[model samples]
Target: MQRFPSAISLFAALSFGMPALAEVTADDVWTNMQAQTRAMGATLTAKQSRTGETVTVEAQTIAWTLPEGIGSLTLTAPGFAMVEQGDGTVQILYQATQTYRMDLVIEGDTATLDVRMDGATPHMTASGDPGDITYSVHVAGGMTAAVSTHAPGEAPVTIDVVVEGGEAEIQYRVTEGPLLAIAGQATSLPGRFDAEMQMGAEVAGTVFGTVGGAESSFELNLPSDGFDILNVAAALRAGLSLDLKSALESSDYTVNLDFYGQPFSEERRWSGANHAHFSLDENRLFYDASGVDAGIVMKGENEFDSPVDIAFEAAAASALLDIPVSGRDDPQPFALRFSFDGLRMGPGLWSLFDPAKAIPRDPASIDLDLSGMVRNRVDLLNFRQFVGDVSGLPEPELISLALSRFAMTGAGTATEATGAFTFDNTDIETFDGLPRPEGAATYEISGVEGLIDTLLSMGAIAQEDALGARLGLGMVTDSVGEDQYRGAVEINEQGHAIVNGQRMR
Candidate 1:
């Protein structure tokens, strides 16, 4: 695949205000586009939804350079010529045959270029092999680009695959910058813009056998303020210090991906509709995306020769991620928390594996709330320093880890578990070289025996393995009453293991 910079950066170049002049030549516009594209960077924002769950990703522009001499064209007298039109526009044309032609028009602040080749042979750069390909690119002004390609012959092309009617386009406009520039006036440093991309493409050959009709699309509303754009340029130069908080806070977006295949097929769509938010104070970052809604459906043929379909939905679905950015000792303590609500899946996905249908087929749902902290001078910001050169990294050390909350509940089965644990860095012998654990964990489970019996009857586990597993379980667990089982495991500073109020080691 040909990699390009994210759509946001492309839009930044596309939406830049043109200079105030009576006329702009096609070559002038083309040169400006090439130069601006090379020096530009912006935030790429997107959202994805799958089965009632939505996720948002905001990233700095990817550093991708176009191929050498990509925009250069050869012109000659008559065969290749530029003519001034009555409308104060210049039209450049290159024509040799019906299958090969190039046309470009420039008027006022807008320019358009279109190149097409049909039934032409493509020569491989290395082996000099011959293949047939037809492709065209249409650029409207600097804010929109569209490309289409097709290969009807069997010979492999430069991409090593045969594609059918692939098409893609990008369009954008400035929303917060100066809309018009004065003569001899310099453009401002930053602005806000809205951009969108519509693309559909498919290929099948030695690369991916026999797949077709795969497509995807994206839309973004982004900001390129002074502070963020400077940071983006710095990252392109030094590859460091990415400000995640600023990117997410700048925009709202959406994305969709769909495909079909022999063994499996998937469809996912999601969006963040102006409800995404982010904040950063020094080395602490807080993110909240409460307005995201998404869902996903997957279907495939199971190994048992039976078809299976699984789907999930979430109403009131939201995702959150919080992280301490600086070292733990930097005044603000280190902490982490991740959680979600209204997650559900089911109606016989498990039945494919359980032929006897012993497991419940009702819709199963889950809710989770987990949080923790690490006490040490560990610097999360310094993590990137070791990516390509680790010799400068500091010595690794452990201070302490604490779990403040661990809570989860499963609907339809009435199962719930809650626990907490803390570890001391100085006492590694207590938990076999792990930070000596100094806290207890408690769990409660229902239908304990029936589940085990059903698994045994289905021969999912060997008899010997089951016996060993049961023996291990018996040492750490005790029945509270009835079919319910409750147990607690704890480790002390002296390296002692205790279960259910009894010492085992």
Candidate 2:
């Protein structure tokens, strides 16, 4: 429904009246991509290849307009040359030896592009799949990367956003045969990355033939995710900021955020009827994400690091869930509500994996899977942590508030238990009572531990914090031996954590 200028006009403008602008960031890239696609009615991928180059794709059946914008490209590799005469025309040359491809269009605050080398394996692999991978990248509540979504009802275009340490992959079935499927994975995470997304939004996709085991994960690790959601949001139109922090094999990233406009969509809803699966491996997670809104069907996997084998439905909603504020007493008013049913998530949560103070994997335990909620409010003006109000919910979907002193719950298959005893529950058949919860909560604590020792050691706890001597042992195999003890008891529910008996969210 949006309109963009023509490419000819854009080139003309840039040829003459340029400059008088500012710097560009990842967000700018996204803003430009979306705007250009809307204008040209085309699908574009920027940063899919090396930077400074643009490539256009004519694979899908679609027409798009170009926008008016400014771009400075410093093409390198195999020697490049550019000449500008007194006139307005310019001559650029590239060494024929370097066979790369680039297509870009800039029109009125929109930039869409596709850059690729002559030969690419991953791109050729994910021919047809569902979902735009660019959507998966969420830089944890900070400046997102740059890119845009091609409008729906248009010819679906596949883009490859390959940055220094980011990769986007996706798979869809365009074969038009008995089975029409679409799925994939994406990421730009480096183990060294200490990224924390207090507020997060990102989109990425990939085609995963298999979803299990360390090898599968190792395969995924080969591909990293790039592009930040916050950065892209800022580029589209409303120039805003986002907060993001990350570290990778050889890269580290950081971004402060203040996002505006629409925060993209928040539903990881992948729709493809026959594309469903159910998996349970390491960790003690149980998920069943199958359904229209949840996903195409029930299918999930667990990292080999998990001690127990787990499986569940794909339609099952997130045990730990967040509700969108449809309407509020006051947009800036000081009240908030959060809830969860059964959450499965990554590590570093409450340092549950730490050997020093984590729980054991055996006797795997957790009962408040039904539902729970928390309703609280505070002076938004002050904006201090660990301080708020707590209202009650009629009935909660989950209820694992704290271990004893203070603790919080999250979602995921594996987490820190009391001590260490990899849950020996590979019996997918025996697993039962898995729930799709709907509940609410209202409470607060400070410096809270994810779970208790026997709570963890006796297979009671399951959280990810500073993995140490034990989840509850209060000590771990200090790798650095610097005594870098992570004595965190922070409290956080909704947006804060509880530590000790106080609030340290």
Show where candidate 2 strays beyond 4 Å: 1-319, 330-363, 370-505
Model 1 ranges with Cα > 4 A deviation: 1-275, 290-294, 300-308, 315-318, 328-348, 375-384, 387-392, 395-415, 462-469
Q: RMSD in angstroms, candidate 1?
A: 15.8
TM-score of 1: 0.49
lDDT of each: 0.37, 0.25
Q: Per-candidate TM vs. native? A: 0.49, 0.20
Model 2 Cα lDDT, one tens digit per residue, 1-505: 0001122112221111111112223233333333323332243333322223322221222233322224222211122232322232222223322222223333223223333332111211111122111111112111112223332234333433222222222211111122111122323322211222222233223321111110011111000112222233212222111111111122112222223332222212232222222222111112222222122222232244243322222222322222211112322211112222233332333254444434432222132322212222222112122135434222222212322112233321222222111111222232253222211222232222334323455454354533442454343212222222232333232333334334533
RMSD of each: 15.8, 22.6
| lDDT, candidate 1, 441-474, per-residue tens | 7766666455566667888877887788667667
